[model samples]
Target: MRLARFRHDGRVRTGVVEGDHVLPFEGDPGMLEIIDGSAEQRTAGPVPLDDVKLMAPLQPRTLRDFVAFEEHVEGVRRSIDGSSGVPEAWYDAPTFYFTNPHRVYGPDDDIPFPARSVDRDFELEVAVIAGPEQSIFGYTILNDWSARDLQRREMQVSLGPAKGKDFASTLGPWIVTADELDPYHEEGFLDLWCTAQVNGVEVGRDLLSNMGWTFETLIAYAARDSRVMAGDVLGSGTVGNGGCLAELWGRNGKQDPPPLRDGDVVTLTVDGIGSLTNRVVTGPQTGDLPPVRRRDQAQARAERQH
Candidate 1:
């Protein structure tokens, strides 16, 4: 069953997407509840899908995005630090970072370019919605929006890329229950064919199986010293084969389709899960920040620029 959260008649509602329509749940149960088989009853007949506005699907309790793909780390590292070798530390385990869950977006939502970014990029990947215990509820296409300029500056400090990736992340169309993808399962991955298109031109394509770490391993690591709640989300990070512009630039040393501009539309389509699309828009402007606090750091910066 494909599950969706949408807005209809001025109220947010939950439903099961079947073909071209949606069967809204009685009392509009939360997505996690429906995933657990809590609400099996429907209020009325199927509503035409095109009529209502689909939401981000899951209101995650936590958003943990992992770098499960070696190729993603390899090329992105070169783009950021100009290094060709993969870090030895990355081989130890699945590494991830927490992002603000309150800032999530849905299909057809407009993503704002970060004020500091001259380049707009998107990471094509899959995400698993957590179910009861350690089980995965389902899958959804993920658009991990990136701001390369601010990301580089953050990486130089060895601490954060918070502002770089914090602005927006689009998820959904709907969630495809794990059982719906049973046929694509191989080894441990769904091995689905995924593609990205910018304004109707196909830019990248890759199989989900290219990632080195399995979802189960990543989930276990996430829950190792802690706990993952029912509505938590875990990302597969960027798949290989030009999933984002930075990776392509690192690999080819040239920008092909160039960075995203205001009004540009990005669509990520995956086998079994359908498409997740969004538009880009200019963000609000802000004032400047204060200079570096430490005199020694300021001197080092002058020397580096010199």
Candidate 2:
């Protein structure tokens, strides 16, 4: 089943998409309702899809995105640090980071590039929403927006992708139930054809099979000493090779094609799952920010934790 969340008649609603129309669910069942198998009932008839404004599929309980592709890691390292190989520890296990679930965008939405950063990039990926028993409820296209300049500074602190990434994420058009993707699944990995484009020009294309770790491994690794509840969303990080603009191919870590700018449109598409597109816009205003204090004026010693 393909389910979508949209705004119709001045109200946000949940519905099932069939062809060119949408069948609104009774009482606006959401992600939780569908996952629990309770979103079966629907309104009397179907409504044309053009009547509603689509929204980001769901607001996840937790968002965890992983670097599950070796080629992506290698390319990113070369782009950012002028490095040649991935860290050995990366192969030890699938690693991920928590991103803000509150800020999300849907298809056709305008994505504001972070005002403080000059380098803008987009990551093409697929994200799965967890259902009952931590199983995948559905799949959707994900565009992880990035401000590479902020990311570079943040990572230098050895504790980041926070200020850089917590800005925004795009998901939707609709969610395709897991069973619908069975034809593409092979040994816990999907062989989906994925592609990314900016301003109608193709930037990258890759197969999901190129990922270094499977969703199962990501889920299991995430569950270590923690619970992965329903509604949690996990991303299959940037697809390897030329999956993102940050994959530099220049001397001294310089970006070749340059970063995204205002008026650029980014679209990510995956076979079976559909596509998600957003336009770049000027973000909110910037305010005065104080830099870190000098080392001499820094704290003499670390304080004990509470």
Candidate 3:
């Protein structure tokens, strides 16, 4: 079942998708209702998905996206050094970031390309939302659009990716229950056909089998010390073999990359799950607003406690 969250009458709601309609779910994290709730309990009010505004499927406390694709890793290395390689440490170290899961885009929602953004690119990936409040659940399509210029500038300060990735991170038409995807989940060879389209034009495609680390490994690594609660999302960093701009080819055009323009629609589709399309739009601002609310504040507080 495709589970989602939406806003109607100024309040956010949880629901499941059935064809063109959405069925509302009443619970804390819909995952609970999905796993244990009866068929009737799981079903609720229905509305046309196209008519109502969709929000991020889950209200995650935190998000961690990991680079699970080796081809993408090599592609990035070759772009940066011309050596076609990275240090051995990269293999051992799974790089990741704590992003604001609250800043999610829904189907048909408009994603604002920040004013500071110079090299805006789309990353077609799979996002995972944890279930059982402790166990890692599964994966879904994730489009981690990036502003390369801002990312590069901020990384030099060593406080990095904070300014770069904070604007927005897109996820879900809905969260697919783990059991629903079990048949496709394997050590190797999960036929994950994924692709990206910008303004209705195709740009990228890849398969899940290309990833360097499997979902299980990512979960084990992520669960080291931190408790991964229900609704926490994890992204399969840019897919193997040029999944996004940085990984694919770099600085080849006249400018860095085309900043997502107003009305530009970006669609990401994963074969089994479904498709998520978002329009590019400027967030509420006078000129170029200060970036959206800071997400790292919560991370900072978490770190202080430790």
The model with the greatest lDDT is 1
lDDT string for model 2 (1-306, tens) is 898989999988888889999988888877677776767766647989888899998888888999998888888877775678889999898899999998988999998877888888999999988887878788898898988888888888788788788889999989999999999988879999999988898878999988888787788788888999878889999997568988754232567777899999999999998889999886888888899676642444443321
| Candidate no. 3 TM-score | 0.81
- In order, the Cα lDDT scores of the candidates are 0.87, 0.85, 0.70
Please identify which of the two predictions, 1 or 3, would achieve the higher TM-score against the true structure: 1
Candidate 1's C-alpha runs over 4 A off are 36-40, 295-306
Error of 3 at 217 (Å): 1.4
Clashing pairs in 1: none
Q: What's the CA error at residue 247 for candidate 3, in Å?
A: 2.4
Q: How many backbone clashes does candidate 3 have?
A: 1
Candidate 1 residue 207 Cα shift, in angstroms, is 0.4
- The CA lDDT at 50 in model 1 is 88
Backbone clash count for every predicted candidate, in the order shown: 0, 0, 1
* Reference-based TM-score of each model: 0.93, 0.93, 0.81
Model 1 lDDT per residue over 65-133, tens place: 998888888888888878996899999998899887888999899998877688789999899888888
Question: Would you give me the overall lDDT of model 2?
Answer: 0.85
